[model samples]
Target: MAQVLEFKLPDLGEGLTEAEIVRWLVNVGDVVAVDQPVVEVETAKAMVDVPCPYAGVVTARFGEEGSELPVGAPLITVAVGADASGGSSEGSGNVLVGYGTSEAPARRRRVRQAQPAARNGRAEPREVPAAPAAPETPAAPEPARPSDGPVPVISPLVRRLARENGLDLRELTGSGPDGLILRADVEYALRAAAAQHRTAAPAPAPVARPVVGGETRTPLKGVRGAVADKLSRSRSEIPDATCWVDADATELMRARTAMNAAGGPKISLLALLARICTAALARFPELNSTVDQEAREVVRFGHVHLGFAAQTERGLVVPVVRDAHARDAESLTAEFARLTESARTGTLTPAELTGGTFTLNNYGVFGVDGSTPIINHPEAAMLGVGRIIPKPWVHEGELAVRQVVQLSLTFDHRVCDGGTAGGFLRYVADCVEQPAVLLRTL
Candidate 1:
């Protein structure tokens, strides 16, 4: 006899609570090996392939693709022990944060069958059917329920949509397997109600407005939603201030060109800017510190975990470079390239997306001159770099066109005052204007 074991969504760590099912890798009745990826899910941070701990035949799956499930919710049930496939009963040793296989065998519980109701005049307990077993074939669809019974809905979002639109879910039949109510069912009910209202309404007055067409609404629930939430929280929680300066970057550009001409590896301009930011932070450690509201203390980081903003097809993501202060220009450039590639391909893990003490945003790639960036939360500051363009400037008391860039620093006011922020910005601007100043620190 095969003992079936249920697997729930494991905690992906870093305070993530839920994940949306992007795609299912295994189907019911399919054989799977231990530690094999069974499903692909999209969390707020990144896309993850969840692995199954048990090696057996997949008996059932809980949710549909595009459905969001909370952590600890049943994901799938695997029939372990000796079976048709001759698989082992022991679970894999691999472990995620919240789930794993142990050396000890799992204990099984036996359910007691309910007693039948008495036929006599005396009142007796009614018998209740046992829960359905995992089917070898596809799970049977749920039978239609009485009007007074609760609707078969799993997602809270589906219920919320129906409630917000004033549609009663009990009155409609769900299109999903097992007669589970879905968002589409709620939407269909809403559209049918609107059409019925329009048909029954009297002729509209001349002053009445006509219905508009061709408007599409997209839900903000994935990467876009995550970015929005973080930015909004940054604005609300951080008392931020911005300071900017225009610097003649002609020398820095020339130095980069020379380095690439003579060098083993090509260094990126962003990496150069990141190098400068790290050096500036070293001088003004106050700007590198975050405010701990609950502790009522300023927390200063000893090492720099620099985060750089990269815009991808998914949305805007900030991938961090660990120990950036210790990396040289070449190393920083290589790490930046690797991270940017991962960001573009949507392969960045949640670990790559978090744990940063400061951020460097280069919006210049989008053709913008400057922007006051919202600080990445828990980080004290962000350095925004603008496009380096030719501008008329006084060089040696003579008017000439020079390669100039606008640099802006947005800092948390709770961490430092305007004087500290200005000083940090001024030091960064000086480095950009004169690359030799950076050589002193290097």
Candidate 2:
């Protein structure tokens, strides 16, 4: 007797409420094996191809491409070994794994320990012990610490940058909402400090603190809207922070130029930087993880899907290069070209935009020296590469011009602290500064 099976939408790691159907790799009546790619779903992160949980014949596709599916909603039906309601017919009927489970009540029994009787007949009401007295209140408030003076609250990315550059956050003014410190503020302060160090004198701390305006509103739609939602959710739900470092992009640029000159497809400087970031994420798997609040778990993936922010006519789209950590520079360059073309033409499928383990955004393309970007929700961190410019540098008692780039890494603080974020950014810089580092690992 042939049986029927129902497949529902699975939890795609980011706790997303709904997902858009990108495409169907398999059609009705097609026999599929367990773990076979059946369909692709697009979440906010990237498009993910879901595999079949059991070998069966596809009976039907419930939804059409481009339709949104709520979690646990059935997407397909199949005929397996037994009837569709084979295993356990509890809440909402049974579906495959990744697809949410049916709601079912479980009965569990617990045994309570017996309590000893009080010595006195005060066994009355179990003779509860008297509560401890409250502590006395202080006469005055405690003094504030030196570090607490006028410190501007900025994004996690700024805080991480400040810490790495040995910046005193209290001395910097904010440019964000309500006097919040901004990534630019931290960068300016760091540059000022670096200049002071070169002059053999410490500059007086900045006293003029800037206050952010009270009523500022930005419409949340398209790319900016998506970025706002992701960043806000990351800051509120994920304990996140940021770190910054300077990368000597002189050699990386040379490599890029050379690669391009030799009949290689022209790739963006950002692509080279992304390749380095992808390599580093492979070495440090923690950076490629997501925090599961409901399960209270940190999930680390074996593969890397490096998501890069692409500004298109539609909005800001992050097209991912799947299995990025395993690919070479040439492969990445080609893939990036394909992704960019698709994004520009608005031909990218929903699946092309989901499933990122880490992200990279090149503010450098805009000639920005340095700025903190918000962390992508669920992903632990995002690496922002600034424009590489030829700046005067002190090299062994001589001042010379060299190409340098700033790297801003914003991470979820709930998972890693300043120190960890710093280490990860530094690792990424090292890989970019010395591409040979990846050669050995790869």
Candidate 3:
């Protein structure tokens, strides 16, 4: 007789309670092997593909694409032979953030080397002498574990990282007790596997990768959904008024080059622009405020949490550099590097990504000349920096080749008018055009 096995959403690493189903890799009745990719899931921070844990024929699918399912909820059912149950168990698979596998009770397979001694050849159960019980008081609820499955003992950030990287949980050998996998184990496995491929002898020539056709519809969830919604709302709801200006960043670039040569964190144009924008906000505090029509308040922040948009495999995520007004050039560079690294590696938390007072989208890295960028919602303004193209400029009626770049500042018309927004942009341009002026504002 074929045994029916239920597969639930595995606790996608960290303590993620739920996740959006991205796409199913296999269909019902498809024969799946152990550790095969089954479905894709999106957590708050990244997109992850989950692997199957049993060899069987899929019988049912519990959730559809874009639907949010709770961790440990039954996602699918499969039919397997009775003899297949005793096979070598690799891990079930890496949990998507807030997602988990089957809700079956944890298998208690303890190889106890030491236990409480038996009395008179009788195995005695260990007991704890409880403190005097409170009078008929109810027991406080315990904190949530991942699910009915084994409680994965890994950090939330590590779980997110593993999910984003498409790592198989079973392939990673857990160092934790009872063979629980850790983040380091997964990372080490990835590195070691990569090294092995590099050292291995050349095999027979492989066929070229297949070309995919047709429009692929990927699910928008987690950070990508949040980013798309906020930007769309800001564009449709907020009357975004923008102004453009060209600034000579020759001096700024020279100063940065000199500073980086002095054995400090190498500052990028975006980092310098971030610092400049923060200083400019000091003079025009109104641009640093948010509008709340429902609350009848214009929330103004005292400190600048400068948010820079970084593109990742999951989606566009902006990790804020907290207190941008306080950090100097070197410190700001360090913070930007740390935030960007965390964002790329899927280690940044929700708090670090949210609560931005202002945003900066740098298109200069892509070598784009200019663009009219949409503002990030709640915040009044977003600045877009264009590429630093070497162009001839008329200086004192004479043609001179100079480094020139455009700046586009988009702001909510309800909160900031053209004059206010223009002044802020000019101030930032002036600061960038002449980096020495930033010292006084800070």
Candidate 4:
């Protein structure tokens, strides 16, 4: 007898809870090898191809393309053993984040392995637990679930989401495979509660609510939704303040032009600025940190992981330059180019998009002069650079047409005072004003 093993949507890391199915790579009865890409899923971070762990025949596929599945929702069922194609029950040991197919890491398989009868295409429903528990002890007030009964939720992320939102998990009805309470169920409950509350409020609520006629409404999901949620959280949680300074970038441009003219690989202004950011962060390590609100402390980082804002067709994504402090101008240039291309092509990974200690936003690329940037939380600060344009400036005690650029730094005040923030921005501006100043640190 062949054993059919089910594959759930593996946790795509970077704290992502769910993913929308972009495309299905295999159909039912298709023979799949271990670690074969079975489905393409678009998480909040990036597009990823989820691989099947078991080498077998795909017996069944769960959820259609364009359906969003929670982290633990079944993606595909593969029949293994002698009768199956490839005839193997062993996994490739290359499962995605938070998923394991081996006998070890018993907690991961507890949701399925405990119930031997539910191994095939059919996963046992929550009622099965309730049914067996109640008939033995019929005198209990609650039969479906007592305080200690299983909650019918497999994904810890779903549990965490409900806990954080002040929503009770037992109260929510599962709409997922085998009556599993997925993240969608919790989200739906929250939305329903919000809608009901809005309706029950005073008559003035009608004035604020959008009228549903002749309006194009889009559900904020995928990348767009992720951006909205992050930006909103940054605004809501961060006590951010912006400070800007106008500096003569004429020298900075001249240095770049000279470097390019005499170089094998052309250097980008962004790399130079990133170098400057790293240097400045070395001096004012306060900005290179994040606020640990629960601990009531500012967690400062030893190394600078510089994040640069890249606007792509997918939306605005900040791809991080890992260990920016150690990389030279050439390395930084190459890394920035690679990350920008990845961002544009929508191939950037979750690791590339997160763990940024600081962000360098070049709104100047969009032809804007200056902006009060929002701090990319839980980051402590962001450096905003505006367009470098020919403007009349006092140079060598004389009025001259020079490349002028505005530098703005938005910081979490909880980390450092305005003096430290001002010093950091001033150091960055100084580097732009005189590129030679950066050479001492270099």
For model 4, the local distance difference test gives: 0.80
Which 10 successive residues of model 3 have the least lDDT summed?
106-115
Tell how far residue 234 is off in model 4, in angstroms.
1.4
Give me the runs in candidate 3 sitting further than 4 Å from their true place. Answer: 1-42, 46-67, 70-215
lDDT of 2 by residue, 1-442 (tens): 3434566776654346776675567765566666666876655544456776656556556666656777777666555442321333233433333343444334311211113343321111222222322243212224545653335554333453565466767776687888788777777777776787769866664444334553445545434556678667877886656678887777777777787898856876666777777767766678888889899888888889999988864467888899988877778888999998877655565557778889998877887888878777778888888888888876558987888888898887766668767777888788777767767766
| TM-scores for every candidate against the unseen true structure | 0.76, 0.52, 0.60, 0.75
lDDT of 1 by residue, 66-160 (tens): 68989988787776665423567666767653334343147742222213332322113232332444445323235434764456764544654
Angstrom error at residue 56, model 4: 1.1
| TM-score attained by model 3 | 0.60
lDDT (10s digit) by residue, model 4, range 1-442: 4456777877676788999876577766567888888887878777777888887666567776567888888888765655554345776776464444442121212112223245444434322111121222123223333543446764544564676467877787799888899778998999998788788874453444567674546789878898898889999999899999999999999999999999599999999999999999999999999988898988999989999999876678889999999999999999999999888667788889999999999999999999999888789999999999999999999999999999999999889999999999999999999999998997
- Which regions of candidate 4 fall more than 4 Å away from where they truly are? 95-213
What tens-digit string does per-residue lDDT give for candidate 3 at 280-375?
899888888898879877888899999888887557888888888888777888888888887766667655777889999997888797888887
Better of 1 and 2 by TM-score: 1
Question: Which candidate, 3 or 4, has the higher TM-score?
Answer: 4
